[model samples]
Target: MRDLPVLTGDAVADAATDWPIAEHRVLGRGRLNTFVSDTVVTPDGATMVRDYLTHTGAVGVIALDEQERVVVVRQYRHPVGFKLIEPPAGLLDADGESWLTAAQRELAEEARLRADDWRTLVDYMTSPGCLQESIRVFLARGLADAPRPEGFVLEGEEADMEVCLVPLDDLVAAVFAGRVQNPTLVVGVLAAHAALRSGREADLRAPDAPWDARGAKAARDQELGELEAP
Candidate 1:
């Protein structure tokens, strides 16, 4: 295997400023820095580079129930132009909560269901070229209905959302028929399949789900062992 190239710089040099919608302060810088700016592109395909902030990876969950139904939410995505089907997910706001904790919180807030079992599906980079956005996906099962958490409203920015439970077969058919098209959801479904085939669904947990450095290594080891054994 070839080693990846690493760049080291003491300070960030602001290159030539292109036309931006609005100028904003830089959020961070180092390996990757972030800035906030209004960047817009015309319909004619003209490109406009603007100031934008870079962020780390986010988390998402594909919560399933005992009946083989997958919990999904229909939310209006500004960039997508309409409501899209997606699993329960959200940004991690609390400083110390683990990714699995965020997944549990999102599931409860979006679907009002708390899963008893969870197995990580995979870690994915949503966009790597211009933006630094990674998403961690999980497979949650053994769900039960519960009360929505306090202050768990998708107000203002996320007001137009409808949550539902969908059958797994329906989801698979949609994928094969070219209906479900989100990359994160696709990865989650494929991971769920591998978990089902190997009967490894019992391993993922809220306190110990593989989302970080050591947990990720352990999960990968378990998966590799399963593949290598008879």
Candidate 2:
């Protein structure tokens, strides 16, 4: 085999591409998400129908306290049938809410904590193949106890959620040992670990950083009139 090409600086990044949708329709609508089918025309002129969920996106918070412990919550996920250990997270379904505001709200609601310092840890698509769910995870420090958001009554799984602080190192270990499988937690833990270890925590993105993926999705949603269609 020839010598592997040496990769250099930050040329590797996700770019958005819009595929031509010949037809689109809503297959179903859930309480918080929409199931849609799209007939896409490929560049080669072949058409394929794909079904996926159009989500309202979400935000996660990795609340790291002074002792380097990370706030986590164990909540039951019905679809996966597991009480997953995850960073506090919630959907961005509220009208006119910013992602940073949503993250702060979820942290307060799920963990009953707030942070004076917030930075973007990472952003990811839960499952791009079949879900348009994008999650922005924030690294939160300078923690303090806070009351739950008013009228945010916990029900079902939320009512049973258990919140605790786990050491960042322990969470990282659990992630590698396959003990924790929640994607947001795993990514946030690892990202926080990497940043702290490399002393690059200060270089992390601002809490209000621009999210191109979300903007692109919103534009596409508008173009398709997905939210307005009855």
Top lDDT: which candidate number? 2
- Model 2 ranges with Cα > 4 A deviation: 2-7, 226-230
After superposition, candidate 1 runs with Cα above 4 Å error = 1-33, 36-53, 198-230
The residue-by-residue lDDT of candidate 2 on 1-230, one tens digit each, is 89986767796678898888888888998987789889999999999999999888899999999899999999999999999999999999899998999999998899888899999999999999899888999999999889999999999999999999899999989988999999999999999999999999989999889898898888878967954477
**lDDT per residue (tens digit) for residues 1-230 in model 1:** 89987656954432322232322334455554344443455556575655544554578898877777888888777767766788888876577888888888888888888888766677765664455456788887788887788876669545767888788778877888888876766777767766776786665444454444334434533543454356
- In candidate 2, list every pair of residues with a backbone clash: none
Strongest candidate by TM-score: 2
Q: Cα lDDT of all candidates, in order? A: 0.67, 0.91
User: What local lDDT score does residue 69 receive in model 2, on the 0 to 100 scale?
Assistant: 95
